[model samples]
Target: MAIRVYEEQGIFHLQSKGTSYIMQIVNGYPAHVYWGKQLAFEEQPHSFVDLPEGPLFLLDRLPQEYPQYGTGDFRSPAYQVRLGDGSRITELVYSAYRILKGKPQLEGLPAVYCETENEGETLELELRDAYSGLIVTLSYSVFEDSAAIARSVRIDNQGEQPLQLLRALSASIDMPRSDLDAVYLAGTWNREAHVQRRPLGPGGTTIESRRGASGHLLNPFLALAAPDADEDHGDVFGFSFVYSGNFFISAEVEPFRTTRVGIGINPFDFSWQLAPGEAFQTPEAVLVYSSAGFGEMSRTYHRLYRTRLCRGVHRDRVRPILVNNWEATYFSFTEEKIEDIAKAGAELGIELFVLDDGWFGRREDDHSSLGDWTPNPSKLPGGLTNLAKRVNDLGVQFGLWFEPEMISPDSDLYRSHPDWCLHVEGRRRTEFRWQLILDYSRQDVRDYIYDNLSEIFSTVPISYVKWDMNRNMTEIGSATAGPEQQAEIAHRYMLGLYELLERLTTRFPNILFESCASGGGRFDPGMLYYMPQTWTSDDTDAVERVKIQYGTSFVYPVSAMGAHVSAVPNHQVGRVTSLQMRGDVAMSGNFGYEMDLTRFSDEEKDLAKAQIKRYKEIRSLVQQGDMYRLVSPFAGHEAAWMFVSEDRSEALAYYFKVLAEPNAPQRKLRLKGLDPDKLYKVEESGLVMRGDRLMAIGIGIPAELKDYYSYSVRLKIID
Candidate 1:
């Protein structure tokens, strides 16, 4: 890990392991030169700026790293701001730069940091808009082991007047080559993070979520690779934003065949009030480069997110196998119903019992009792503590659910403070899920919600919490934001939510928190920094989960995929897969159950018991192993995935046939990430196969395994 600035050559070079990021100062401006595999650095490197001939236009002549509009060098701006004088032009020139031993913290943001000076080094460059006195400090931090560079910007108002920021992108990269295809995540509701790869062309192509939450339609991730690149070969560039709010990620190929990548806060309906002496910090973006292909890129991202992004005790700990009551009982469950479920789950070896929504205030459905965190006396007689005690007595951990960010018009909290909800006074409030969003931008509102939840934690023996945000922001206005700063409400609300989460998680360190936004709407690395796992999606069918979990595996570890076994004739897609198939699919992630076990048949119950015992024996392998996507669901009729333990001494593989064919030829399964010389024995059958022959010649799938059938092979190195 190193960061060196050559003043004589006007170059700043950052190296991490085998990757290098080089930038040059051209005419007192930073110009992007190269970012890929490491190259020997000296007075001269392979830089586009070194070209002797170019267009007469200033911007066309130079390859800029982060350009701004109205700065003579005009292509596309990395940042744009409007001053109080009604000027939208921002001409920022490099003012000065400084190097630090380690990363400096971004106040009130969930940013990646260097735990020690030996882990990384930081570089900060100050750019100024002389007219408005706006000082934009671009900060970059490079880590030693992960080869990830974190980038963010701090915009401070040095003038007496206020400045309105029209655009605040986290990081932008200028690549000399434009022949790249973009890889990104795209889906809706039950299907999130479906991979989409398209060729990067001229003009700008953007993927954004203006829904307030990082909507289910698009996840905050993007990758650029040569059109010929595949899973195990070629160069891939990855970019992931660590913010959970509205965001924009764009890849643009210029008329000159140069590509520019940018990511940050969604500029639409976004204008930050940078008052005198105030600074606004954009969320950090992570940059990764992999020459060995998408598989290696995924491993890098998985390692980075698992170790550096997620926090607290659960970061490396084995998560409990929980049974959530959402799919089982939904809104009509009673106290007795919950206790019975818990008792049955304990009998089946379930670790934790999560009492999902509808335990509070008159919340028989989604319409009422959103902000009232107190338990409903009728449904949950004796409140939550008494029920929790009974469940705990049954030898199972207890958990609860809360939607503290929304308020119902019928609830006591909303009636008392109608202004507490986000609304434009004269306009009719738009309701999603029959509730209005709370004005989290207000400190008073955050305090009220946090105190109410904290009171329960202090009294009850709750070991876990499922924090849910049911809907995104609408009627997008905040009463407390006032008229002048109303444009700042969305960003402020995110900050306030972050503060609340930090306080709650810090105060109750023992509680395991799982983030959910109507099921995977708010799934991003930003929330993972606070909560170790997220509800992957609302759809739990084993067949559907193949695609869902498969796409998510690109950036998140298996530890973060909240997979569960729901009822047959599945709730979401209504596809009745075998019980073993569902269990096998769900085991690929943070395993859990979502169906009513009380209704399980004797045979089904025995299968679950055996499955739980098996998981206890092999979850460590699944949770920590390096995953190999053997066959993509999008590519063929079969979906195959495998996990090899870090030491390569153990491996578990799952194969599923989506549809069976008559008299189909036997399929060969070639394993990956194994010691070539080692001999391995299968657990169920004592047959031994050499690692080299298994990968070189391959093995066969069962002939009877057909039509949505699934099979798993657990191998242990025998020699």
Candidate 2:
């Protein structure tokens, strides 16, 4: 693959493979720089310069020469400069001579360095732990079309021994003022749950910019106005921006090790580590230029996001509408109870029956009886195979739940193999809700889970698997491994789970899987690779879900979101809402119902039936349409969204005015993604409106009919 860089419209474009891996960077906006051709070391400038004022020391001092391999160390390589204007770009740089002597610290010894520069944007990528015979390569490029966007980096390792290296990518930017707007997306980690945007200064605050065992530094800008910097954890304002526009970072070892890519309002600072013959990559973070402040930025963010990431294939095969027993039954339900719920759901046209937790083992709640894998006799007396047959006989597919990488301290599996859990031999194992994480890193542990899970699939004719991970890593220490091996636990744990899921899906391709972590905890592309759909949130109250789903849809399509109409008062939020309103919200995505249908009143049941029927009719269009965001939930007092299918033949629009002003009257809303040349028929009056007229006049509709009230419009393409 050829690496090429060019400039267009004041933007720098980098391309690989003739035009593949394109990335763009706008002039004056800090850019991403990488060196070391294919499998070479790479680097980027850090966000800020906050080194301690002593002698600036190079990482670990290496002797001038090492005797084992050659005259020069493999870590050191040729350095080249590509300068333009006042930019002295260090295209590539490598450190000199070192060898791994099989010692604990030097087993993976050779360390290489690479650097890049674009105007003020610069970074350095390093490859350490080379002595272990690991081959490391880093890749980078800029887009030819738009320089404001940077191409993603890829780290590939070709080595024999596992190596651990700290890989950091950093960048710096010049902001107009200390009051800069910044946003970042992050997954749920125990202590690193929040992202704080604070001033760095003698006049600013320096909080932990990056967390985890790997240490980092954050220096604030020196302020002229304030003398002392104030700091608070929850003071960050930009959840909507971070959730939708932010980047998700992760590391992969074995084939690839770890990654650290930086994001900054000023510059970039990130890094990673790798084992011999491993690789790692960072998720792409799309940045937009907006002077309209956070609200306008958020609006455009959602709009562009819908046009890009949210579009997907429409399945016309008619997916079964499923009802999960988790929210309804939790861990306390019998076979008769599930059958009753299944029967009720079937009457309402629900096509899938999912039995949740407590079906397995003699467990009653989350605290005990994990890893046993046996069906609880009290709740599932007829055995899972028989239960599956009965549910299948009801004309609905059967599904079950599993938390494979977890064990209860009081469970049989833990008692028999205490070493199976993640813990240090002498250190106390951390417990969350009476549960401990299974040490899937071991082949024995992995095999055990694989065997049990495979058996369940073989024994039962289940059509779905709801994979759940309820807790994050805490007190991360492993018992079976030595101290050097403990740090590898977290990454290995995830890999083990990935391997297990991959096997399960490959073996049972027809069975659909839904990933759930509390609610949206582990909702990332990594998990989506195996499970197409994910439960959006445990909070199903329509009002709260509007924002949650809106934020989620920016990076994910509606088809991938699991939305259900739960009865009010909601279990999480004790507010009672209208059943019609709930259905209206739920219909916009993958539709389902979580509440007990038998508990619904006659009128409510009728409404449920009607809503299900409506969804069935439009599900095709919803699944295969181009989503448009006209008004953002984080912007105005109202929230509005629309979806138009390819060819512009069909469209579904929804607008909700949360709080209406006194005489706001009707608001004129412009519809998007419509073919201006085609004629269309509005469903309500059978009135025909040409696409031009619809686009020109737009739709004049009331902004607020009532609190939580909504209006929907449907359009059909006419030749």
Candidate 3:
């Protein structure tokens, strides 16, 4: 990574492994010059300010690095502030700049990091509003091995009086042309991360989440791709906000055909009271550019996130093949029943047994006992310690689930602290799943939770924890906050959560944490920083999962997805699929099972045993290897993908057909990411084929297969 500057011409050029970003100072303002394929630094880079146009027209047309409101730019501004005199218009001019050898951490927020300072470089540009004494610093960090640039903004109030910020975005960019289509992920509840693409309109196309979460309805990810971009060929630019709270991303096309894209915290119902000498830092935004297509773009993110973004011991280790009891016995399982399932799972080579919900308080259902963390003596007979030891004695590790962020009205904790939840006086507090959101913004609330959880972790031999949030925020008012600080509740809540997680994760470094917002609702980069993995979705049916998991791969790596094989008739969609298909889909991610193993028939038991054993043999490759997409499930009824080891010595390919066709012609599956000069042997067919021929000519599909049929082939290098 390198940051080049031409002091005389006021040009800054940042170069990553395969891309470049250049900006220039024009009339005391930072003007965006180019951002694409790498180019040598030139003292006289092309300038938009030098175009032949009127003074007003030039200001409107020039590509700005960080545009401001009321600055003659019609497009959306990166930030907006109100002064003490009630004036909103402000213009910031470039004042100074500093370059650093490494990236700086965002205060109280999660961001991507490098292991060594030499792995990346950062450039900070300071702009100042002399009249108002407002300083905005734009930061850009480029990595040595990845083609991704991390961007964020820091606002400092240097005047004597307080200032209110109406909008503070993380990053913005202006593309030279408006010839790309918007590609994003959108869905809801049981269905999450469904890929959607559309052409850019004349005005702005915005996607946001106001639910105080990176909602299940819209993910904080946006990609602008060429009109004809496919999996393997075309230019694609991706913008992912590294935040788990409410956020907005927009793509606006101007009259001159230039597209301006902006992403950051949702500016609706959001404001920050910046006191003098105080600073506000926006969350980081990751920008990726890929000229080879969407597939390459995804691979770049996978490698970076798996190595640098996710921390802890589990970051490099293969995830455990565990079984959760949520689907087996939801809120109604006894101690004896759990032990029986644990024994059966141990017999089938399962590594961990997760006892989910109903083990605490008088919590027979979701309506009560959320905030109370004490285990129920009636179900366990011998406390959590005895139950956990019994499960461990059965040859499987123990895991537990908790919804610490929710408070049920009928619980003891709520009764004791009546004002602990988010609420507005005389207004109704909306409850989803019969639980209210805890006001995490308060220090007392966080301390209560931290102390309680610390006690449990220290006492129990828990090897894993499933952190879940079952609902969104409503009536987002903090009881302890004054009127001036009321609007900061949402942002403050996120900050509090980060602090809590940091403390817990550090205290218990050995325990693996998996985050879940009712499954896939809060699955963003911010959560991934604390918890390495996330439950992919609530719907576990193999057929539905094919599409769900496929869409999720657009930005997330396989190691970060928690996939499990559930019962035959799926709980969410009631779709019955074959065990083979379910196992095949689940093996692509952190492999596991969520159904009752004791209830399995003799044949099913044998099949599951074989599946677990096979997964153990290739788990490392699937979890750590590079992935290639051969066919898209969104475009047709068939889906195919493959994982190749970093050394190109081992490969695993899977193909699935949702519905079978009668009298269908023969077809071959093409493979990707292979060495063309090497020869390989296919384990399934027991035949040898050249790598080039196998990838070029492909392999044939089984002739007589039924509905929901799936196939997998393992390839190993042959001398």
Candidate 4:
């Protein structure tokens, strides 16, 4: 068994493929012991319960694995409780624990699951607040060949009166002082998920997304690493949440010199009422330990999320080369024009044609008809089916864009059901993108969206759906929920969205779904559970994308990144980069084009055709291989990255020079992640070279390349 428990020693050890996690109970309270490189130390029964004098007498000094409130610990609590009598203190004690043969499913939440009984095992630590009669069960699961420990909590209200839950986090970990530095993914809308590393000093650093999306500003990922650790070496501890709502992940240093990491729902505007016989389950948070450094940690995450966390028909399948019509034509086009673009794309080897917004509900711009789902006859004269058929006739798959969670004030749906939006009495409705967020917390609203989308899916032959949300929540009040439960709206909103997605994806299992929120605002693991890919950024400028993709690669794999080549003097950054550079950077991810094919010159069309043909050659390696960052764009003028196949027989490297310094010396690029003893033949030049020399002595780059220029080389094992 991967999971083992020793009652005599009160120790629980969870052993994954390459890592070990140890926890112990001291006087009915759990404390984290060790989590790092796997150790062979057996658990020998030893007594640590004898109360020591002075500062050690205080519970705060001990490394608690799951600390509670009101126990005089004075530190952050894993779960906070309030009683009917208005007491906010919780005195929790460990009651019992069960080691199960298989993992139990979390109710109303998405979590990683064991595919079979033999794949993994689970453990549940049951704790009780004696005075309040509140039972909290912490669930942990360890897989057979994975290093991720899935952690979550279940709070069952067994008392006579109702209880208020203020801070119910998914997981909290305690660590002894190792002089660790914290690393997290942070950025705003068009520039999301940039890696930021800093010292975990006296004060705490909190990365949260209260924007109701696991917002683009701060993704739900955090890491605590030793100060000397870099990308390829040292120990690193990673924590990531699987929920797509308002979340908080923090790394704080206590006065006692121990660092406590916490992750779960943001309690700022969150409160859940647990009635008698009811239970509340926090979203699952994954904890990974890598004594081999961040790259190994990333590979572990990439493996787990890509294979287990994500689901559906397209999970492991190659993503089609789709060209979205949003940047191509925005809100202006007709059925004939769409067919023309589809024809052009099909002629250029594009596999899918995605008809973006303004194809439905009398919509001309972002101002109107968001919730209406009917096809606009004026734009699509033959309706969706006819257009889809026309596009399919051209040998290209049909895709579409939809913003179902939004309702425009000028829309017919809002005109009929004004109470459907999220607004309180006597307040002017707030609007972003000229639309109001439909209160998904209302079952009727969710049913409306699900039914309408189901109808569209049943009628249209679409192979892809670009699901998008343009803005954050504004009013926060749901008309269907009770007044006392106002704080639950935000979380319920997320659950409702998940419910909708679950229904749609399960119903239409063959269709591929891509999540987008103003080009990556809602990009998080929670969304990845349902949608395999997310639009990496709205900024497609190759120069800006280098940094954007770089920061995102620290956590997300290239398979999850949606990159596209847009019109030059790029739509978002307005910097003109060569077609070669743009295509090279975009090909590092799920490659596609987001520009008009109707306007391209014969030469430009040839370039795009060549780019598409070339990408198809290395698509699998780029999508599924182990990635290595050779040079840091965060600290240098040149950006370089490499990907090696799982078997280490093939590799692809991309080198970009952002700026040309006057009289700059020729750069020698050293490749990584290749088998050192094997010889590789460069496909471009048919030149054979040893991998050791390629990495140690390096390859001489061309000096004729100037700024905004890029080069890519593919290498295969020759002998």
Candidate 5:
């Protein structure tokens, strides 16, 4: 009931109760799983030892020692252990030292290798650092068809004073033979942001340099080929595999303090602090597969991800079309302003009203009042519950925004308990956007946030929560912890945040949560595990979004993206675009609007209403469609993409012409993935065309003579 492990047909299944974890292992997969505190051998040798009622484990025996080379004059002895049946196990050894000059290196330890063999596979666990106080136990259990493996490192704080320890898990893999193509997906503002393969080295691998919105440098390590005889050309890769699976990953180390999780590729290394007697753990899953090409790889990854990962949890029957007040009015809105906008939004058939930032505390801007959960009296006058009630009375679901992990130095929360912020006694604390991060790692802090958030939801008839984390960790240090313990802060911070979110979401299942980290910052699979959707980006301009959404759709589904139509000249770009164009672009995703509805002209209002009506008509198809990139955004001056529903009964195509040649005739576009035998009706003219003819000759459309021009075509399959 707690954790289940099964093996069948050379495959392993690991399931955790009430959690999204469903780990599967395939044939020839070299892994093992163990339960209780005993060593077991079934084809592969493994063992698990329980610690003294704590979160730790130990592997007692290891193989004999072998002399190994190290940097400089240092030579470390390497060793390995053989099981009863004579199978070899690899060993890793470490020793602690205070203030060694330059970079210290450990070498000559036995390396565990996993490769395919005819009958099955073999895994060997070796212990190298016998003198070190910490020992890692590798455990596995063989199932009918497969096996499961877990590696746990055990540390003993037996010294008179509690030891502050820095621990890291390093995995060195042989580089892929061919060009390794990869994609990292994060959910931002209802859309996924992707960083894809560019190029790596003389070999064939490449590392993505782009950082996540939360400043996490993703895919920082890349090796072209495996380590060869040439020492100069060797590849060393290491990454702090932060928590994975569904749910947002967060870390808080007191307000204003910073914590970081780092990924180092070459000269492989991982370093995180653990306080005296404090233990930390981070979970990550690695997937490896070979593909003939990038397209094949992409397709395979998407298939596996959607099938095994995504939770198709669709609730709130209406498919809410919301208007977030931040994009509409920013911090300049009042009760009157919200009422006016809500009235207009209701008339336009918008289903949800989200009161963005500045509705709470003295938050006139992002610089203050992050931790204070109280509603801004000056702005709302009658408290959030009353305002929500009034907004609900106008026939729209109410949503509110909260940046729970942030606090301003000027805020009451920080003023009262500065110790709640992360800081070192002698080290300067870090601040971003004039705000500090809270140390959610503490039990009290977690309880405070949970109670506050729960109170807000319980007090108001709120149906949705916009959870925002605006900045990343900087000036990494924690005040309450010693220097060594500070290193453990980052991983612990993320775990604490995860625990809080899990508790909150479980207690309030009906409340929809939208993860927003300055719009796409922390938009990873981890966040999507909790929030069904995320804000795609802070830049809501239609022209820019065409490219952004196109790039995002490469990995994420449209339903998960929060795309909104804002006024133009767009607030971010300052380019005046037609409202219709904006609405059309936004329609490709979970459609909504951010512009102030009351500010729109009567004609614009009518257009908004019509757009909402059209969205409702196509929402189902858009949400569940099989998207196709008919044309690459990077292929030409114009970017084009299309979406066809799973049933292939309906299709939506979007084309944007950023530039046009002087006299180039209309371009003919070849359609893809269509039902060739079926007839189709174009929504634009209600004109019927044979699917075969449409696919064969394609559609011809004139290019835009100016920049930022777009065209959309809808098709319905006719039997």
Candidate 6:
């Protein structure tokens, strides 16, 4: 059993493969005991600070499993609520708990799941406020195969009167020590998910996104590592929120040197009204502990999320080598031109060809026709059915792009139902990319989108869908919602989006849906539950992607990232990189091309064809293998990573140099995650070496490598 309870001692110990999280009920309050490397079960007195009496109670020093506001604890709390009497003071006492055989799903929310009953165990602790019939249930799930604990909270309004929830976070835990560095991912627009780290200080350190979506500014993830922690050594703790809306992850160091970590909905411009018998379920928060290092932590997340969090037919399948027309033609292309590109992509062995924007309602550019799902007769003569067959006839599957959550002012949907957008009544509606966000918080709006999309999906031969949200929310008010429920718009929008996706993906199980928010804006686990992959970034420059993709791998698997090679003098970044470098970088992920294949020279075409063929041969290995990031792009001018098959039968290593140095010394790249005793043969050089020597002694890198130079070396077991 992953979860063990000591009822006599009022203690609960949850164990994963490599770690244990222990908590105890102290004076009717659930307090955190210890969380670290796995320990043998033993009955012993827990070490705790003696609480001082009266007003100066040492509640702040007590490590709490779910701390609340208005208590003696001065640190950030896990939850806050407003009672009917208009007071925010509330304290919860332990009521009851249950140790279940399997995990329970969060109502109307996405979370990590257990395929079978034996894969995981769940513990639910019920705490209640005696004064007001309010109940808070903190649920924890421990998996048998991964070092991760999934936590969530369910608040039930048992009282007769209504109450407003001022703040509600998913999970919180207090660590005994505070000597660690806070590692977070931060970036904006074209550059997303850059690794940033800083030492933990006495005060609170927070990374959040209040831009409606998870925003490109900050990811819903945070990690605390020992000062000396690196890729291969020391201890690290990672927290990832399984949500897609505005969220905040915070770490606060109290005066006694104890650190409390919390993550969930941002609680900024956010509130929820719970009526009698109503309940609110916060999104799940995943906690991962790594005594081995950040690399092991990443692999734990990769394996768990890849298999448990992501669902549907595509979850275990290799992503198609696609060619998206967004960067190639933008909004300017006709039926004939599109077919030409598809023909060219088919010749280069691309499996899927996507027709991007401008294939809708009088659409010419980004300025118009967003919510219009129908194909534009001007660009696509016979609509999507005709265009899909044209591309499908060229021996390539057809894909499409849709910004369903957005509507342009000139679009027919907006003109017919002007109040369907998210805007304050009588206030100027904010327009981004010449479009306004649809009020998905309403059922009618979701129904309209579902109806339209279902029609198209049923009629066309579409094999893939790129669901894009180009802009974040502004003037986030729903015309149909009451004033008291206005604060629930953002969260409700997310729930509605999830509901829509569930319906669409369930109806069209075969279509591969890739989520995008201008790029990596809405790249989060919540979306990943519905869509298997996401466009990693709009910036496809090979040099830039080195950092973007590397940073993303901290919490996301390579299979969940949609990376593609674009044209030279890259559309997002004007840096010209070699075709080899671009292909090498893109091939490291769900490989694809976003360039004009029809314009490629004969030599370029031949190179692309070879790249496609190579990707086909190694796609499964790359998608399903364990990844080892040898060198970080942020730390030096070179970046390298390797992938080893789970069975230890095959491996691939890639090395990239951004710029050449004059007379640089020879360097050897040490590999990881390989069978040390196995003899492996390098396919490229026809050289054989023992895996132990290859990893310990390493392989030589090109000493004369130039700027933007890269290479991928494949290894297989010797006969």
- Residue 158 in candidate 4 has what lDDT? 90
Tens digit of lDDT per residue, candidate 4, span 417-499?
A: 99999898689898888999999998999998999999999999999999988899888998778977999999998888888
Summarize candidate 3's per-residue lDDT along 568-647 as a digit string, tens digits.
77999888889999999999999999999999999999999999999999999999999998888899888999999999
Candidate 4 contains a number of clashing pairs equal to 1
Could you tell me the TM-score of candidate 6? 0.99
TM-score of predicted structure 3:
0.99
Better of 2 and 3 by TM-score: 3
By TM-score, is 3 or 5 better? 3
lDDT agreement of model 2 with the native: 0.53
Predicted candidate 6 versus true structure: per-residue lDDT over 1-719, tens digit per residue: 37778887788888988899888887788989888999777767453434555666567777898898987888898889988889998899999999887789888899999989899999999999988789999999999899999999999999888989988999999998999999989999889999999999999999999899998999999999999999999999999999999999999997889899999999899999999999999999999999888999999999989999999999999999999988888888989989999999999899999888788998998888888888788787777898899889999999999989999999888889999999999999988889999999999999999999999999999999999999999999998999999999999999999999999999999999999998999989999999989999999999999999999999999999999999989888799999999999999999999989999999998999999999999999888899999999999899999999999899999999999998889889888888899899999888889999999998888676578999788999986
Give each model's clash number.
1, 61, 0, 1, 60, 0
lDDT of 6: 0.91
TM per candidate:
0.97, 0.69, 0.99, 0.97, 0.71, 0.99
Clashes of 1: 1
**In candidate 5, which residue ranges exceed 4 Å CA deviation?**
1-176, 179-197, 203-281, 286-319, 687-697, 702-704
RMSD of candidate 2 to the truth, in angstroms, is: 11.9
Worst 10 residues of 2 by lDDT: 105-114
lDDT of 1 at 316: 85
**Each model's lDDT:** 0.87, 0.53, 0.92, 0.87, 0.54, 0.91
lDDT of each residue in 294-317, candidate 2, tens digit only: 333333333333332222222233
Writing each residue's lDDT as its tens digit, candidate 1 over 131-229 gives 888898889888888767899999899988988888889998888888999898899999888889988888887988998888899999998998888
Q: Which stretches of candidate 6 lie over 4 Å from their true place?
A: 43-57
